[model samples]
Target: MAHIVILGAGIGGMPMAYEMRALARAEDKITVISNNPKFHFVPSNPWVAVDWRKRDDIEIEIAPVLAKKKIDFIGVGAKRLHPEKNQVELDDGRTVDYDYLVIATGPKLAFDEIEGLGPKGHTQSICHVDHAVEAEKGWQDFVKNPGHVVVGAVQGASCYGPAYEYAMIMDTDLRKRKIRDKVPMTFVTAEPYIGHLGLGGVGDSKGLLESVMRDRHIKWICNAKTTKVEAGKMYVTEHNEDGTPKKEHVLDFKFSMMLPAFKGIDAVFGIEGLTNPRGFILIDPQQRNPKFKNIYAVGVCVAIPPVEATPVPTGAPKTGYMIESMVTATAHNIRDELDGKQPSTKATWNAVCLADFGDTGACFVALPQIPPRNVNWFSQGKWVHLAKIAFEKYFMRKMKAGTSEPLFEKMVMNALGIMKLKDK
Candidate 1:
């Protein structure tokens, strides 16, 4: 029996385990190795920071769900990956041998890159459930004595949606509390513009986001490189288009949340020919490492180059739907290989995301995720917020049921002509 091992059990890995279980032969053993037993829906972390969601609302005990599907689960996490021997060393002094390995360990939050940034420092974060919970307490403390607020992504950061979401969510919550006037908000970002979003602006995203921020009375500084952050203050250098320093600002803030750069987890870092210099797995179009054919990677663990050079460094985002496509392709490719056939499936890598703003939200669809796409659309409305809520509920249910893609989800994607894999 061919054993397929899936590493990590967060947004990308859990679905990958389910999809692999569905596609593999009945006798093929599928196992998932995760650092934690609970799976937290990462997109809802912004809500958790603002009290819209509790810890239990977004977390699922993944072991029970995987057990129902007849899949093995190990929560000891990965200590080291011996790709040369097709063996994984676990933290609990155990080893797993697999014919195929899917690495979806997600990104290691690089908070230490900036001094006084991240949950352990001056700013708070919504990148992880525990971090979001801590931010909730910080939020509580801040609202008691409202002052300046700072929110955005820093240099070398990739994921920008949550930064935008948290900023707007906090704005909405403060407005509801009638203390918005007491809080002056400033958005500091690494993107050259308000809505670059690392894909070079998806269809008027810049215009729409800038307009919304203006409506909310939120000021912004783009192409900003945060030099340092002390308690209650932030130092930033705003860069010009020519890469020159346009201005420097030292702003005081009562509360701050800045998304940091992401890198591959330490388990597989520094592996020659397997990962880029940043520790992200190097994958071809099929999501398989060129040097290690039996190894595949998806989600933030995969290396994607920036769309274009910017005054301040920024990388492209690998959103939820795009990661799902990668997972689907990886499973199918492994199944083909197990059947003594060459792997051929390739993911569409489409980008479809809903960025909630508490009261309203923005939705974008980039057909290929990169520039020069067939369909690039971004729009905002209250219905988008409602749709995000519905998605969270449906996705959680689907995970609990161990279903890769629910019938309704498939139907909706089909109706929209959104294909997860390229037609062969």
Candidate 2:
């Protein structure tokens, strides 16, 4: 029986394991490796940071859940990947062999690329539950002594939705606490314009997001390159469209949470023919590595070029719907290989996202994540906030049940009238 090993147990990995299990031959073996023993819903991290959701509410013990599905669980994590030998070295000095490997370990937050960034330094983060927990402590202290707030993603960062979500959520929280008047918030981003979202501004996203920020009294600086962060101060260099430095600004803040750039994890970093210069796994349209045919990738760890270049560099985002497509495609391709057929399935790479602002939220849909799509839609309402919360609960339930159903395709896309959009 062929053995398939999946690295990571996050948003992409967990679903991959379940889907693989459902599709693989009963005699085939499936194993999931993760550094963290528990799986936390990453999208809820912003809520966690603001005390809207607690850690326990989102985190699920991984081992038991995988056990119910009859999949082996390894929490020791991966130290290195020896693709040539088809083996993975574990952190605890063990090794696991696999007939096929799926790298879904997600991105390694590149906070050190900038001076005094990240939780270890002057700023806070919500990339992980642990980071969110720590940020919550800072949030508590900040509410008591409100001051200037800095929130946005840095250069080369791929994920932009969370940065926007947190900014709006924090605004909502402050308003609820009746302390918003005391906080001056600024959004600093590498995108050429507001709501570029690393996909070249979806469906009037630029105008809509800018209007929302204005209404919320949040100021913004685009094409911003964050150079350094010191205690209570952040250094930024705004850039012109020609990539020339335009202005230098020194902003002071009591609380800051800047999304850092992401790169491939250490286990697969610098692996020849497997990753790009930034360490993201290089995958063909089928989600299979071109050089290493037996290896595939999904999620944020997969390499995707920027939709368009701006003054400051930014990477394209692999949103939840896009990643789900990748996972489904990867599973089908692997199954096809096992059946002695050439891989044929391809992920649509569509982009659908819900950005919650606590009380109200926005939803956007791109037929394909890249620009020049058939359908580009964006809308906002209180219903989106409710939908996002429902999505969270439904996703968490799906994980616990170990179901391999495609949540995005079956629910989100359908609800958004994707069928009608596609017919256009």
Winning model by lDDT? 2
lDDT of 2 by residue, 1-424 (tens): 9999999999999999999999999999999999999999999999999999999999999999999999999998899999999999999999999999999999999999999999999999999999999999999999999999999999999899999999999999999999999999999999999999999888989999999999999999999999999999999999999999999999999999999999999999999999999999999989999999999999999988899878999989988888889999999999999999999999999888989998998888888777689888887878779988998999999999999999877656554774366457
Model 2 regions more than 4 Å off = 418-424
List the global CA lDDT of all models: 0.91, 0.93
In candidate 1, list every pair of residues with a backbone clash.
none
lDDT of 1 by residue, 1-424 (tens): 9999999998889999999999999999999999999999999999999899999999999899999999999998899999999999999889999999999999999999999999889999999999999999999989999999999999999999999999999999999999999999999999999999988999899999999999999999999999999999999999999989999999999999999999888899999999998999999888999999999998999998998999899999988888888899999999999999988999887777789999999877787788799888787888779878888898888899999773233523742453232222
Model 1's C-alpha root-mean-square deviation from the true structure amounts to 3.3
Error of 1 at 24 (Å): 0.3
TM-scores for every candidate against the unseen true structure = 0.96, 0.98
Assess candidate 1 and give its lDDT.
Answer: 0.91
